[model samples]
Target: MIRILLVLILLLTPYHPNSITGSKDKLENQISTILSRIPSNTKTGILIYNPLTQDTIYSHNIFSPMIPASVTKVFTTATALSLMGKDYRFSTILFTDDSNIKDGTINGNLFLKGFGNATFSSEDLLHFIFKLKNLGIKEITGNIVGDDSYFDNIYYREDWIPDESANVKLPPISALVLDRNKTVSKRKRGRRTIYITENFKNPPLNIAQKFKQLIEENDISVNGVAKSGITPDNVLEIAESSVAITDLIAMINKHSDNFIAECLFKSIGAFYSGKQSNSFYSQQAIQEFIKKNNIYSINTEIVDGSGISRFDQVTVASVNGVLETMYFDLKNFESFYNSLSYAGVDGTLRNRLTDLPNGFSFRGKTGTLNSVIALTGYLMSDDKDELIITIMFEFSKGSWNFYRDIQDEIIKSLAELKKESSDF
Candidate 1:
């Protein structure tokens, strides 16, 4: 995987935008200036639409298939909303056929069943513990077993970027997972080559001491680190887990968390097709969903729902189509759309689209790699018109300045259209 990712990086050399060619008044000219200032090596795919006519007004490599980075979340979140209703909430359940409850001790295996809830958390796990305690269960004499029958246990996709910081908070897809499968870490004052970490999951009071005891018995020293796990596949007691789906999405859309995004992608697959959803298979599900919805077919490619894969691609039309669909279901639509990173406020867009009118008016998911930058989502024009737009840069050549320039130009054009339409 490292070799393949490295090869991809080598092939993705930066290219600045050299020029923009089109016939839409000065829009193209302005865009061209921005593009030219960017190195010609930037790989950019642009598509603009006149929604009144439902016609494309400007396009360049609109469907050649390139990476979209976090823009892939649009599909993951959208497909999830479609397959699972917006109001859906994932639940974790405890079941035991025989419980020999006696003096704070139960003599049966504590079973955990995973139900494809991507938002499960440590605090939530604590809630489950409370539920169990409410049933007069204080201690268990038998081991724990996780039942992740709802999802196939195929964890990890081919598209994740490996250099990312790992966390136990990010757990593997299992029939039984704690805290959305995340582990905990403790920050150490020293920067030793080996960091302090722990996989002790569950209510801290119940298992922390036990976990330390076991580690001590094994002679593996811990540095008392404070960090979470990426994903765990072990059978452990359920403790305190507070992170939930709502928090997960906030991190995903606001911080462009690639790990959570990857997890959500797999969860989407697990939800519909069991664990049979791989990058190829899950993308098929999303693509088919798009086709069924009559969205543009030729403009999107998804290898991972998180857009981290270099193979993922998307278009302004497809994104616009999604936003248009949301117009019909405000409840779910708002949930999904609101999850997107606010420009300059959260996620990947934190530093961008900051100075627009009305405290700025773009709601988008931004994507960036070595040389690629993409922005796709809805823009609220100064005239109160909501327009869906995308400005993507692909390459061997790409530049942040170029992407920023084209994005501004696109917004400018939309604002102009809003004024023109309002004059009538």
Candidate 2:
């Protein structure tokens, strides 16, 4: 008992209470001053961590649960990396439950089942056909039945810009989908062509050439017109340059590709824990993951992984909860961080931090929809301390100035804090 008391005394002796108190005061003052500086009516929130004082510099509105837009990709990508190993590859398989085979002339229709294989590429597709060929399956006699039953048919978020949604590229979600929900159209320029088929039954280019010839036979010469089209029900042949989801995501973050973002969402369900490979089970899985991980509470309702939904809502506490979960998983932590666009290098941060303070911070993901804007991810101070920051804005009409200025104010303040810490 006496020895314990002695140890406690020694532990307390060197502890500087005033120093700790001073640090708190400094951090609190900094946060308050920064919050006060924001000019807009943006419903904004923030979180900061100071390693020196072991403080979780934080703000409450951070969990205001605003629309995230494509920023929802952050959740999806993170979920994918967590559930499906980073190295896990999605495979597109071709198989039929029949015994008809005769030099590419079978009596039954060909079947194509898609499992949201985001990685499905021309090469992978070719490989699948080769596998089919190896099975002595040469011809399909029946029409292609694209098996998209793997997922529930819940495409399109509750809130989407109608004008943007109408574009076929931004088509509603579907199982057994292909190519950013679009198809390639090719036309021939040379004359002497004939026979064009609207069904695209075979040799599309040849058929296109034939069409041009017919047009010429009609005494009309037009060859340079590119054909406009949607992807075929069954990918008859693989291409050498069709972009896959990996590249899409690469561009998705870099250029903020909304089309690619939505197309890839279906891939999540098809890849894992889905009733059917093409089902939109991603949201359920995410909720379960959140519940199982005990990070966010069960109340967080996520419509689309992307925050394009106006009905989506998350709490500040839950946001922190998710962040806390991320802090421990190092591999996931790294992947999560790396996946975000670098301030100037890529991702949503392209024009953001080019000449700004937080620009040079670690990296982050940005979300925007109509009147909503948000920023989240890691930030580092000059002292080498890493902080997780989540900023969300829900500003009213004529709140643009306030929305931007407030975020900038918050960013500038963090920059100053970083600078101040480095001075020591």
Candidate 3:
């Protein structure tokens, strides 16, 4: 009798995917109503997916081609994580052309050759200088040369606006990046542009100059003027970058560092092709990678790693696919996911979603341009399900605050979503 009762109960519990579907539809409708209040002239693209069930819960204008702004870093970082392992570390080597030395002086020029390490900083330079001092070569007979020959001479994208150079986020793209290719000036009126500078025309030359200063400060004599040059095959490596690739990816995504994104993009091309890095090669590699992942979309376009260019276009569905693929990737998920900005916690999202209710966490990237706004990342809904959400907007006349509010509302609604219960 007990066995019979158990069998009956098991047989009576029917599959209720349709009920869940109905709930999802209702939730989507409610969110759509909120989205409609933003602006009539705005072109929007949105997609929400359940990575666990591998289903798109809600989609609107998912196929529309929209400018993603900095959200394009999602594709850049994801492709990088897939191609380069999370533990990968980019090396910026300090080499000496000649090995012979006497009286603590080098007989040849010092070469600083970078293989696409964007996180290279003043501290790294100082540490390298210390290492040079430890090498018992206090004096250098030749100039300090910065070699970024791993990439092309085109440091700035053709499509980027000339005025955009004033913004630090769009720093010069180079293989050897030091302090993000920007110089810090004394503050005035409590105002200073993060990316603005008096001179950054040549990134390698700028880095070389800074390196020369650090060397001189460290009491290591650099007799020669710093300039951009190439290191010979026969050279002695002095120092390299200590930061891991995951950390660099975090910097790129969390802060939306355009310089790092472009460098990484070019590095991807250089890595795969073993040739000089260029945007065309990077886009080809990204396109091939996108295709290999089966993320097919009619309108997907990528010209630069960072979405600072107005020419970049990507479909909502394609970006969703990219996010879903990265989230589910077993080996690289932690590094990739942790790199995103966590809403109300830190990164670009440090101040957003502060007024949300309990059981909500929006971890993602935020993108903003004069006419574009985008937010894409993960939303942990009530600790029961995880949703991948991407919200993009291209507006003619609307305040960015309004768009951000709408995006936050959408995320809030999704976080509060629940499955319907059946009453038979």
Best by TM-score: 3
Tens digit per residue, CA lDDT, model 2, 55-172: 5665665545556555565666666666765565443444444454545454543445544543343445444555555655544444433444554455554333333342223444
Pairs in clash, predicted candidate 3: 168-195
- Which candidate number would show the highest lDDT if scored against the true structure? 3
lDDT of 3 by residue, 100-214 (tens): 7545888889989889988888888888888888878788889999999998888777633333432334667888888877787654555654443554679888889999998
Candidate 1 yields a Cα-based lDDT of 0.57
Cα error, residue 253 of model 2, in Å, equals 5.2
Which parts of model 1 have CA positions greater than 4 angstroms off? 1-24, 50-57, 99-107, 159-176, 179-250, 274-281, 328-331, 397-402, 409-424
Write down the TM-score of every candidate: 0.71, 0.67, 0.86
What is candidate 3's local distance difference test score? 0.81
RMSD, every candidate, angstroms: 11.6, 9.5, 5.8
Give Cα distance to truth, residue 258, candidate 1, Å: 2.0
